[model samples]
Target: MSRFTELKREVYEANMELHTRNLVIYTWGNVSQIDRDASVIAIKPSGVPYEDLKPEHIVIVDMENTIVEGDMRPSSDTKTHTHLYRHFESIGGVTHTHSSYATAWAQAQMGIPCFGTTHADFAYGEVPCTAVMSDEQIQRDYEEETGVQITDAFAVINPEEVPMVIVAGHAPFTWGSNAAKSVYHAVVLEEMAKMAYLTKTLDPSRAPLKQAIIDKHYMRKHGKNAYYGQ
Candidate 1:
C-alpha cells in the first residue's frame, strides 16, 4: 500500500464534499491536503467528475509541484496549491471552487464586507478580493500568479484569521488546518456571500456591521477568551 494512502483518501473525500455540498458542478473545483512531514500533498485529478473520482485517483505532488506519486495529472491549479503551501506554512489544506455567490462577488471584484455577526463569527473582517490579474501575470503563469494574487492581498490580513478569499475576475479559494475545515470554510463563505448580496439588494445604503459588534462576535469565537464550542 502507498504511504500516502490515508492522505489521498482524506483529500478524495474532501473533493467529494465540495460536490455533495453543491459548491461545485461537474469538474469545477478541487481540493488538496498536505502531509507536511512528507513534503507532499494529495489532490484531485484534473477534469475528473466527482461522480467518477476515487481515492486512488488522487494525485500526490511534492512541494515544488513535481509528481511524487499516482498515475493521474494533478489539478491544473496544482501550481497555485503548491505556491500557497510554500508560502503559508500554517495551512494544511486548500480548496478552490466556482460556487455561484462567492464567484459573483469575485466577478464583481468586490471584497465581502462584514454585514452581520455570522460573517464575523468566521472571518475577522471583510473577506478580501484580490486585484485583477495583469496581462503580464496571465502571460507569465496563470495558476502561479493566481497564488501570487492571493498572497499579495493577504500582505496585511492573516490567513488564520480570514481563511477565505475571492480572486478578482475569478472565484473563491479557502484554506484551513485540514481538508475538512477548508471545505467548511468554503461553504461558510458561499453563504456569507449570498447573505451579503441580499442584504445589499434589500438596503443598498446599509452600512457595514459596526466594529464593536464585529469585535465582540469574532472574539467570542476566536480570541484568547474564545468560548464558542464544547
Candidate 2:
C-alpha cells in the first residue's frame, strides 16, 4: 500500500478507537498522525460523528494548522495539536479525549499520582494536571493558548515523571511517536484515574507509590528480561 493510504487508514482507525472505547460522545474527541517525514498531519474533521468518519473525510493540515487537503474543516483542536507536533520533535501523534474519569480529575485541577503498579508501569511519577488558563489569555488565543499552557506547565513541573498532562477544566491530551501509542496512553490514563479516585475515596490522604517500587515496575517491563507480550 502507498504511504498516503496508510496515513489515511491510521487516522480513520484512531478516530474509530475513540468511539469504541466510549471516550467520546457525538464528536468530542480527535486523533491525528504525522506524515512519514513529519511534513503534515492527518486529523479528523470537525463536528463529524464517528459512524461517518472516512479516509476521504480526513483533513490534512500542516504544522501551522493550515489545511492542505480534504473538503471539510479540521477539528477545532487543530491548533493545539499543531503546536504540540511542531514543538515536540519526537511526537508523531496527538490525541484529545473527553474520557469521563480523566476529565473529572482535570476539572479538580489535581495530578494523578503513581499509587500502584499499574500507574507506575507507564510513568515514573505523577501524571500532571496543568493550571487553568488565565482569563486574558483564554480570551486572546483560546485553543492555541491551551498548548502553550500545557507546555509551560510541564516546564514549571517536570515531564520525565509525568508523560500525560490533564488540561485544567478540560480533557486529556496524550502524545507518542504514533497514533496507536497515544490512544494506548489515553486508555491507560482513564483506568488510572478511576483507580486513583477510588483509592482516595477510601483514604483521603493516601500516599504515592514508593520510588523503588515505581522504578522496579517501570524497568521490568520496559527494560531487560521482561516477558510481557513475548
Task: Go through the candidates in order and give the C-alpha RMSD of each one to the true structure.
Answer: 0.6, 2.1
Count clashing pairs, candidate 1: 0
Model 1: residues with Cα > 4 Å off, grouped in runs: none
- In the range 1-230, model 1's lDDT, one tens digit per residue, is 99999999899999999999999999999999999999999899999999999999999999889999989999999999988998899999999999999999999999999999999999999999999999999999999999999999999999999999999999999999999899999999999999999999999999899999999999999999999999
Q: Residues 1-230, candidate 2: write the lDDT tens digits.
A: 33467787898898898889888898899999998475889999999999878888888888778888888999999999888776676777889999999999999988888899999887767888887899898899898999997888777543434557789999899887788778878888899999999999999999998889988887787656765665
Superposition error at 197 for model 2 (Å): 0.6
> TM-scores for all candidates?
0.99, 0.92
- The deviation in Å at residue 223 for candidate 1 is 0.7
